[model samples]
Target: MLTIEDCIALSGLNEAEIEAISEHEHIPEIVAVEYGNYLMHSPDGVPMLKRIILDDIAAAEQRNDLKHALHLRLVLRHFIRTHRDLHKVAN
Candidate 1:
């Protein structure tokens, strides 16, 4: 079985990204790890992950959680850099 750390390492997703996913989706870290792995591997998951992160950022903004919002934006930017082709077109 894949550990959360292993999945996280393989998924190319940062800690903040995973945490945001967990918080926004009300999922546990281990489940978030699996979801992150699925997102990294699936053909259509990257953009979906991006959208999720963007939504999280917006939610953070609404709550005035500037730190979290900035962190999510950074995560999304890194995701874009690593998976440039995945986000070729803007949503």
Candidate 2:
């Protein structure tokens, strides 16, 4: 059987990006992997993913977890950089 790691590997997103989607959507990692894949292909998906990551960053900042907030920023950057074709979604 394929493990969660295997599933994550099949998706375009990295583990951190999958985790952020899980956290934002309140889903498990495996589910997030599938959801993230779906989002990456749809037209409006990039902005939605951006919103999710931004929300995560805001939540981390709200709790004073600057480290996590910074990490999420990196994740956001990578996400944007990875989905270059969809980058014109106009944040």
Candidate 3:
């Protein structure tokens, strides 16, 4: 059977991204992994994932959690890099 780590690896999203989606959508991490995997393929999906990361960053800042905010920023950068193609069409 596949483990959570396997699922996470397959989803191509890091734990931070998945956790943010779970918190934002109030869903389980596993479900978030499935969603992430699905979104990785759909054109609208990456944008939605970007929105989730942005929301997470805002929440972290609101809570005065600078460390987490910084981490989420890194995640956002990586997400942007990984999905650079998706953004190119907009430019």
Candidate 4:
């Protein structure tokens, strides 16, 4: 039985990124983990996750949660730096 943490670790997404995906897709974190795992292997899914994180940052700002918003921004920055090739097309 893989725990949620294990699933998340395997997906290569941080908690904030996974949470963004969950909220955007209106699914639970555990389900998002499975989806994330799939997405991590797909070219389209990388950009999709980026969009989800942007949406989450916007939502946080709308609620006046600057701290959370800033944190999420940092997470996005790190994700982008680490997964730069994920967004590129072979052709």
Clashing pairs in 2: none
lDDT of 3 by residue, 1-91 (tens): 9998899999988887888889888999999999999987776787888888999899999999999999889989988897788756533
Number of clashing residue pairs, candidate 1: 0
Angstrom error at residue 14, model 1: 2.5
- Which 10 consecutive residues of model 1 have the lowest summed lDDT? 82-91
TM-score, per-candidate, Cα-based: 0.82, 0.89, 0.86, 0.84
- Once superposed on the true structure, which residue ranges of model 3 sit more than 4 Å away at CA? none
> lDDT (CA) for every model shown?
0.81, 0.91, 0.87, 0.84
Counting clashing residue pairs in each candidate, in order, gives 0, 0, 0, 0
Local lDDT at 63 for model 4: 96
Highest-scoring model, lDDT: 2
> In model 3, how large is the Cα lDDT of residue 75?
88
**Candidate 4, residues 1-91: lDDT per residue as tens digits?**
9888888999998787888788878999999998988988886888877887899899999999999899889978987877877755511
lDDT of 4: 0.84
Rank order by lDDT, top first?
2, 3, 4, 1
lDDT of 2 by residue, 1-91 (tens): 9988888888878999999999999998889999998987787888999999999999999999999999999999998888877778645
Per-residue alpha-carbon lDDT of model 1 for 1-91, expressed as tens digits?
9776787888778777788778768999878877887877787778788888899999999999999899888888888897786667533
Per-residue lDDT for 19 in model 1?
A: 81
